[model samples]
Target: MTSIAHSAAVSAALRDGKPVVALESTIITHGMPWPQNVETARKVEAAVRAGGAEPATIAVLDGVIHAGLEDSQLEAMGKATGFLKLSRADLGYAVATRKNGSTTVAATMIAADRAGIRVFATGGIGGVHRGVEKTYDISADLQELARTPVCVVCAGAKAILDLPKTLETLETLGVPVVGYGSDEFPAFWSRRSGLAAPMRLDDPADIAALIRARAELRLDGGVLVGNPIPLADEIAANEINPAIEAAVDEADAMGISGKALTPFLLSRMLDLTQGRSLIANIALVENNARLAAKIAAAL
Candidate 1:
């Protein structure tokens, strides 16, 4: 394992026992356009701070795995071109090759675990894609959740996925999918997925208690806390589902697979929704960051 390069703030927070939240870098790299990406990253970090915790945005830069980035580093990354979209399989290679890369949810989990960060915030998790029986395409995020001991706070699995199967697979993997303040699992841009969440907790302290119990019981993995997007920001399921289906169908037609599939689908969805999806995505990510900060504080 590579030794992580920690920002001074992150190192101090860990030493002083202050709450700190881990944030994924792929959102800055793959999920949005340049200026907005950096702007949103700042906003998400601000949200985390407002909730009483410092945020550690994880990324790999020039052969070093950075557990947290400084502002100059974030700006450089946002403006740079051509970086690897790293997951569990490619993280070490990107570092060994002295290349830059953005951390996906799975990759972020690995970095957070290495740095001793216990919570992460992201837009949404990748999961079993639609029509996966043929592709057998399950996201490394799910597998990471089954083993990494970092609490992941997100809206839920990306709405472009097969939610039911994602939920089933999580259950089978022994990953607790906890709905924060709701019974239904959140669907990224939408408030509800129409699927009952396997577990529910309304308070951050209660969620923290669950995490602590898992540690005491020697459970190996983290919990997925589904924090719904604000009602005013949500694109209703009825309004968003068609756009999602069209995006998926288009990806199939274009033969976009693996890492390329998500960016492709998200870009298509943005076009189909006339950029409403991007707005919702920003809202949900900030919301998750706030919630994750609270959870980290609780811990």
Candidate 2:
């Protein structure tokens, strides 16, 4: 009666008790241009493999939620058009309607949890958008993090959002935000946000212990591991903030809102930063995938 589907690799990994890291597929279908998107996805998977875990790139294909995807399936989805960008709100609806879709952070967590996978890796998570007081456009990723038990590894909240408010919101929701090796929380492409992380734990084994302790204490929500982007690839906050601000102003001027806002802003930032943003993005995601695999293996 279970409606979920799993690729042979994932199912076998689960059966054999091997570590597996869940990857969000929106990174393929919506995060970038076709060829680069597929290419980055492959590289991310390779990073996870190199880190000693199987990678389960989660997505919904023709309305069926799949925990892992075949290479051919990934190829087709990367170039496919009109796929739903699914999050907590739309993931179930997409499945019921049999729609082709890419999973966001929240959707991936939901799928990964249902498949009994505990860890997920992603580029960045959505947060309180700039000017959220006027539009109240907080991302479902935050609330889903509060509800799901999966651990999500990311650089941090998207640099395009209001970091202070996003951090405050996570605190209010009782979600753990752990900085991997730094006191300051990361800001997506930047290594430091200038804001203190709620907690800091440097080693992956310590992080795995914290996750196990959560289970022992019967905690209900997820932990966010803020793994900073590698130093060589980072665009310092001073340099990236201006591009993000310019992109936000442009998005507001264009009246872009809801799901349309993120992709538009990201695309605009890529242009404003002369493609450095995208390069940093690819770097951070691969780094997160690498760390997530280690954490999963530890767990």
Candidate 3:
């Protein structure tokens, strides 16, 4: 069996019964260039701390699932190359083979649950890819959300996905999709996805109560909190939609599907939007982290 290694901070937080937020590591290894990735990661961690929660940035290093990373470990992870983009399927394989891997939402949720952490903050969650009817390339993140008990706080599904279909799938899977202070679902870089949220809640304490209510009702899955990006930081939907379409088109033409698809589309959009997408991504991630901390505290 693969062992879990918790950083000192996370262990201390757990022992003391303090709020702790889980963070995914793929943003460091596959989301951006080295220095910026590391810098954004540190900023997100700081945001979580500022909200009075310890940040547990989860990843797989040398076969061990780490609930939190030390500063040096984070730095090394950012600079490392050839890391696997691990989800539920490959996470165990990476560990069995002693390979270094960065956890996606699915894998991170699993690790967070194992570590007894409840709240996870991320920029976006993977969902039904565009052309899913043809390609059938749904993300493992959706299924993870259906079964894992962690509460996921994200800006929303990435704009490149089929938002309507993703929401439909979540509904089918019985996952609660709650918008934080908005009537509409968020579209990652943008604040609106053009779909009404199934549920809405404004306060972190209310969300915490919802989580408890789910447990009380014996529901066996996670809750997704769609927190919109700050108005000042959002890339307007009108401005971002075209770029997303173009990038998706390019990926389809190039036959880039599966795990490689999201990263490819994101990188292409960065070039297409002249780096604005990355800026918005960093902002939204920090925003989500702060919200997750508050929810954790409320719980």
TM-score of each: 0.99, 0.99, 0.99
- Native-referenced Cα lDDT, model 3: 0.95
lDDT of 3 by residue, 1-299 (tens): 55689999999999999999999999999998779899999999999999999999999988889998999999999999999999999888989999999999999999999999999999999999999889999999999999999999999999999999999999999999999999999999999888999999999999999999999998989999999999999999999999999999999999999889988998999999999999999999999999999999999
* lDDT-based ranking: 3, 1, 2
lDDT agreement of model 1 with the native: 0.94
lDDT of 1 at 87: 97
Cα lDDT, model 1, residue 273: 98
Residues 1-299, candidate 1, lDDT per residue (tens digit)? 56999899899999999999999998888889889899999999999999999899999999899977889988888888898999999998998899999999999999999999999999999999998998999999999999999999999999999999999999999999999999999999999999999999999999999999999999999999999999999999999999999989998998889999999899889899998999999999999999999999999
Clash number for each model: 0, 0, 0
lDDT of 2 by residue, 205-234 (tens): 999999999989999989999999999999
Residue pairs clashing, model 3: none
Candidate 1 — which residues are off by over 4 angstroms? none
Worst 10 residues of 3 by lDDT: 1-10
Alpha carbon lDDT of each predicted model: 0.94, 0.93, 0.95
Native-to-model Cα distance after best TM-score fit, residue 81 in candidate 1, in Å = 1.8
Candidate 3 global TM-score = 0.99
